[model samples]
Target: MIFKNISKSKLTLAFISIVITFFVWQQGLRDSLNRPSVTFDISQKEQEIAELSLQSIPVNLKKIFIINDPVDQINKSLSDVSFEELTERNKLIRIITSELNDPKIYKNISKDFENKNFKFLIDEIEKKSNNNSYKPSPDTFDLFKGDRFLYHLLSRKFDFDDSALITKSFSSKMFLKILAIRLIPLFTILIGSILALKILWTTIALKKFGWKEIKYLDLELIDMVLLIAGGFVVLGEVVSPLFSISLVELFSRNISNELSQSLKIFFGYLFMAIPPLGIVYYQIKSLNGEFNFKKDYLQFNFLPIKYAIIQGIKGWLTIVPFVLLISLIMNSLIDNQNGSNPLLEIVLNNNNYLSFFLLFLTTTLLAPLFEEIIFRGILLPTLSRNFGVISGIIISAFIFALAHLSLGEMPPLFVLGIGLGITRIASGSLFSSVIMHSLWNGLTFLNLFLLRT
Candidate 1:
């Protein structure tokens, strides 16, 4: 009966995964179709023209003064100016001055050439050229202009080119690309969810079949508090200082900024991982023979691979909506803040592959392994035993969120911690929670990568 139930659940999950994959593929196709056909080449040419016209102003103005009709004279002067001569600032100035003098051409002038001082000059030219009898339309002059506004405008236009290129590059093979990008995290989530359910089912079945009561080491409340506090101090006081200031100063003196930064991140996390693991080991050792190697210590027990994977997927599914909601709210509230994880910022900004690899390793692998052991393996269980399950989960989860020291991120982190705690209890193994945490970080890393590319 249990086998039949498990088989049915697997089929349902497979169907859901297939449906989601199809939906994502369809959306990607729709996005590609709606993408703009425009390219950066047109904008680049316009910028060149604006620069050339600005430089040719003086020469064209001379022609404008010699002719009765400034519009025809300026147009003829512009047509004569060679592209090579446009590189000279003086020639560019002449061309721009000629364009401003002609009402018809000036009306269609690029906003790049319209500046406060330039407009004042144009008004002065009109007063002198027409003897205050004829005036160009007010629309030809920009009211609000700044220094080097043209350069700024060019930069802004160039920024959208990356996204435009991505849209244009989409093909029939896009489904394969999307699947490849998302596959690892999707599998991790699915397997984790399944493992969690299987573990719960197994525990219930065993209890009904007269399984013996599980026993844990007799840890005092003070013992739990001390261990937690010790880990925090080691991370905050010992590891943080080395990374934040000392290592940076030391490395800056000896190496390039890029190498120094990479070394700092690698060594910082290395040091951070050691101390917590050492502390946990020490605490377990202090329990003497009372600590059951297989069952009492959550980290020591090996959950069935299938059950572990299912739990991870379930935990991720439970927390994803809350994580997304908090992320949206936080982003809206702190819109000015760069919407990037610090580790992600380092990964994206640095060109050094070694540095990128080190950063990724620290965040995705080492951080998850050590943190899950400390929080879920040690803290959550200890707290649950001392303070009852609900209070322990809530309290430990709150501390986990607080440790991040980000108000904007606290809500999401807190929710994630709760999910991890629930998985710890349901699966009765630290490994399940570790898998979930790693998968969550992996998903976030992938998200940032997509946004950047």
Candidate 2:
């Protein structure tokens, strides 16, 4: 009874953990996506265009082209019909290829080509240069237009916004805009910091962490045990639902609508199932240890993420972005219970909400723990005892991935499995693998429950 109760308690905790994590995660998403922010970029671009157009001479609008739409003006005056305003515009793309034959025409219209007419400007700019390139775009008002091609002619006088001579190209103002956007990738680096902490804990208990308690997590059995147990759990996870659905269907006297989600879900589970079996077989063949069954039974402390956050990033560590980003996409694919199976349908979908909740718990907590134990803990150890480390890790990782039901989610999961296995091997403890496994699952649940569209 105690053992059964403990098992039930653990499962209950796992389930509750998913629910709580999801709520917090969704709140974070709502805050991030729906926050009201003031941005004046569009208005700024409009103002710049207005200034250029008002000028009697044709002012260069290309400098602001990075953010602003192109103009199809014929001369310095008149806001007549522009080519960009047209709906069916196919000839615009040809300028880069077919239009290359046109001769340099923009001559003595303004500055170097002080041509008063558009044709004259084209004639001058189109003149053959030593570079063997210089084609006049035959289309008038092509400059600074909405088209993807050079909507307008490139002017030497436009002048580089910043270092026109040093970098040879890329205006300073434009460069800054690009730099700002690219900085978003920095989010991943923050994730890397967390991963780094995990590595450290895999080795030493976070001394600078919560109360600095000596928490040495043994990792020796993680990979091999995980390899076997993870595989078996994955099979069970996939198979149980299938059997449930089939049995329900077999009771054809009255078929419930819930069967709809079951069929596709079966595919989802199938996607996960095939991969883990191979991993276990490979591991069993590799390791020759007098099978240590009791030691291989996986166990790990439930990480209070609060503690994980502080201790995980305090040491020499980097947060992993792969799982986070994947979680982001996965979260987008699901919601608290939006994309759930129809068994929830049989229970008027209130059960759906419950099932959805349960699904989160299972995927995030239960799946990760047992799966990691079977694949990384058991199988990997078995393989290493016989074949060696490299082969064991690879085989187990592959099996871990193949065991997933969602085929689309497989590639990323495989990569994650490998990382988990590697960490387990390095730390020589199952705890490290469990942490990684839990982290991956938690992130996915967070994405789904916490951050929804």
Scored by TM-score, the top model is 1
Q: Largest lDDT belongs to which candidate?
A: 1
**Per-model RMSD to reference:** 19.4, 19.3
TM-score of 2: 0.37
Give Cα-based local distance difference scores for all models. 0.54, 0.42
Question: Which runs in model 2 stand beyond 4 Å of their true positions?
Answer: 1-188, 193-242, 247-319, 322-352, 405-410, 450-453
Deviation (Å) of 109 in candidate 2? 54
Over the stretch 241-344, how does candidate 2's per-residue lDDT look in tens digits?
Answer: 56655654565435334334433343344444454546544544444333344443333323454443333222112335665467567556743212222222
Residue 43 C-alpha lDDT in model 2 = 26
Instruction: Give per-model TM-scores.
Output: 0.53, 0.37
